[model samples]
Target chain A: MTARPKLVLENVSMTFQSDGKPFTALAPVDLEIPAGKFISLIGPSGCGKSTIFNIVAGLQPPSTGRVLIDGEDATGLIGRVGYMLQKDLLLPWRNVLDNVALGMEIRGVSMKEARARAMPLLERYGLGGFEYRYPGSLSGGMRQRAALLRTLLVDQDVVLLDEPFGALDAQTKSRMQEWLLQLFNDFGRTVVFVTHDVEEAVFLSDEIYVMASRPGRVIEKLPVDLPRPRDRAIVSTPRFVAMKKYCLDLLHMAEPADDLAA
Target chain B: MATKTTSLPPTRSLFTVLSLFGASDDKGRPIRKLPVRTLWSNWIIALVQLSILVTIVAGWELGATFGLIDKFFWSQPSAIFKTGVIFFTEGDAFTDIAFTFRSTLFGFFLGTTSGALLGMSFWWSRNYARIVQPYVICLESMPKLALAPLIIMVFGMGLASKVAIATALTLVVSTLTAWSGVQAVDRDQEKLFYSLGASRFQVFSKLIIPACIPWIISILRVNIGLALTGAIVGEFVSSQHGLGRTIIYAGQTYEIALVWVAVFVLSALSMVMYAAVAWLETVLRKGINQ
Candidate 1:
């Protein structure tokens, strides 16, 4: 309880003018993620979940709030936290090794040195032979792995992943979820994941932030309180089912107020 | 049995189409593609294409011999062929062909290089792109061929004017095509680069440049023909020697066979250049896609 939070968002709100009409996209929200813990933001569409990510990633400024990284008021400042989107975004012209080394390369690491640094990660993560192959030749699952490796290699203490596995098929998604939990345990980085899948949020997250839409804000922050190093078999367990059910119910209950407003 | 037979295509024909599109196995996995580019298959297509050419030439010859076609206006194939032999063997065809070839190649190299660089530089500043893009569009819409006469006047009826005209025709198109490619870069990819603390120059050089390379290479195929047309147009306006000059000279003298011979040689030369660029595109594609 006394540990310093790795990332903090205080009263973050976002508004925009859509067609000259003032639109409130995110209501004032507060969040604190502890160091080395996995946090997940799960919500319906238009829930400002990604807006928070953009804020945390330092891509956009919140209209009314501040973000703190390692207790610094790092608001709207870029490169504080590593960021990954839903797409694997590997540069098609570069091979896997070079793609994984992209963030470092951009920071002025010599290509030879970057490749040297990236080779071990590729081998450790089971991509040894594929370091020279291009992204076009890799399978969908492999591409995402390479993307995740790229984000990991950014070496930021806090990593933001926005629906990284949303595009994968069911079997691949489940497999990747388990594999991701392993990587998370190994790296021990603070991860804030955004996703629409309730099972996924429950399986990987230590605490889940369930957001509400219309006037988007974090309504409930529920801690999973499950055991660490969880397995895929837990998805079928009664406790996991109940947590998933509670999330669905919370999501459903947030919908009626929109009906009233409409 | 009747329904199945009606629903399914004949096995061999379906197999061929499926092979072209990439056939999947019974378990929905893509199969190792049968080599679609075997020489034997291409040879069959080549054979059919050759037959079409042969049929056209044979019909033209027969029509000219029977006096069904005007030999004076549309020179007979044999006469054109004979003229082509003489032109290549003994006339100044070498000089003219080389002149046109040099202008086309220089214009192609210069236009694509300059235009692609201009297009790429647009990625550096939003204000620059916004201010400059409208002018690019206006230039693209302008019929540069109409300016060939003025170009000839200014450039003084030499290879310089022809090269200038060719460059004008190709430059704007490469800029526009490459600019569109720059614009079409995946937004998410750009965001990824930004999140990595990429400087504006880093984003331009690292992400924007290589990512748009396929788009830039694709324009090479289009610009080659435009360059050729520009060269020909410049020659028509005024030039010392070129295929374009040969055609215009033959037309004025009413030597129909020489005109046809020059036309045929120009078409053959253009085809060769087109094929070379196409092969480059494929090689680059393979390298990028590896």
Candidate 2:
């Protein structure tokens, strides 16, 4: 916790034009995420939470400025970060085991080794018996678990999750949130997750960065002081409730004043 | 997963094959039982149909004895049966049937392979699609029968000309449908693979083409029929052998029975080809819906 930042974003800015005028999406923002910290970017729709992840993931080049990962420039840092999308994106034709081993497959890992490495992960996530079942047959929660396992199997230094459980049912989402927190604590992978859900960010993240619309800038950063190895009951705890309130206030500020003040 | 099925079940499954074929009756229910009005009250429709067919032949023979219709123009069923017997006995009719069957099968294979490959090529390259798609559609809309003479002129009155005509007729439709199938692949799935660091070639093979299998099978079924038509029409226009040639010869000699026999054999050939494609469609699509 006393070390330098693992990822540094210096004066990162992105501008998208609509109707022939330059509309700024992300303002020149500077931030630092310490290594092994679980960070969540929470914002209202169109606040560019996804843009931030995309920028960091190197899927999109920043309009200006640079992203540094592990002291290297972002351009040369691909495959160092594993990205999981909102959709499970599991290849439907492949079985559960293969889906979990996909990133390793892409990295030129041998089939035997990939399957062997994925075995413990699949078993740990309660998908051991379902190794041969296709993704189409798995429940949404199970698929997301497999997707997370896939990202983990890649052995990337940083993990970027973009609303990984946004498509799940409310009950399943709560269970998955707890599962993710437990998994993060056990593995201690540095996570930069993007979610619009204030509660989810509060419940799972070690630090929450709230973003605002119009200029997609970090308006507030709240340190989640909730205890580690969090459970379902943590959602109703006083600390979690206070953090959610802080996020709500930041989100209110992020919204255009005219839409909320009235 | 490899649980063996009893032969009895497979045999019973064929009884309901029409329902599996997606055919429904007027009441929107599957016609699992024989319909009353089809003139076949028997268990096996093909068998009952065959029996009724033979009774019609008997009636026609009796009618011919009583001079119901002119025998030369509308030949009796018995005479048709006799012509079949004669063809099998003294003539080279079996060879003609075999020739037609050979060419039809060859044409079907050529049409399917080239069509699939060309269609996949179009799918792989946008420029190819843009360049060849218009020409393909144009050629598809043209009557393939009209191309028979031109094909004969180009390749001579050989099996090559017949196969070429068949390929030209079937390939365009298959290519278009296959291209559509490839294009219709889910973008979400593609993005998933792309994010996983799959190259374009891997995505094309692992995601796009596998997703297009059912669509390709549908196109294959339709093209098989077209391929047969193209082959026979090509033969009718030029070749000295084949069932098509036999039909033309019979027509010239006013041998209506021989013409009917040739037509029946060709129809059966088309049905067998179609049935094989349909079976393949079942096998290919079985795991997809899951």
**Per-model TM-score of chain B:** 0.81, 0.79
User: Each candidate: what lDDT?
Assistant: 0.90, 0.81
User: Judged by DockQ cut-offs, is candidate 1 incorrect, acceptable, medium or high?
Assistant: medium
Candidate 1's residue-wise lDDT over B1-290, tens digit each?
Answer: 55554565446656566767787676545578466774668889999999999999999999999999999999899999899899989999999999999999999999998998898888878999999999999998999999999999999988899889989988998898778888999888899999988888888888888777888899998999999999998999898899999999999999999999999899999999999999999999888787
What's the CA RMSD of model 1 in angstroms?
7.9
lDDT value, residue B193 of candidate 1: 93
- Candidate 1 lDDT for residue B4: 54
Off by over 4 Å in 1: A236-239, A257-262, B1-72, B75-82
Residue B119, model 2: Cα distance from true site in angstroms: 2.8
Question: Could you give candidate 2's per-residue lDDT for residues A93-175 as a string of tens digits?
Answer: 77888778878887888878999999887888778798889988889999999999998778776888999989999999988
Report clashes for each candidate as comma-separated counts. 0, 0
Model 1's A-chain: what TM-score?
0.96
Native contacts kept (model 2): 0.21
Alpha-carbon runs more than 4 Å astray in model 2: A76-80, A257-262, B1-65, B123-128, B287-290
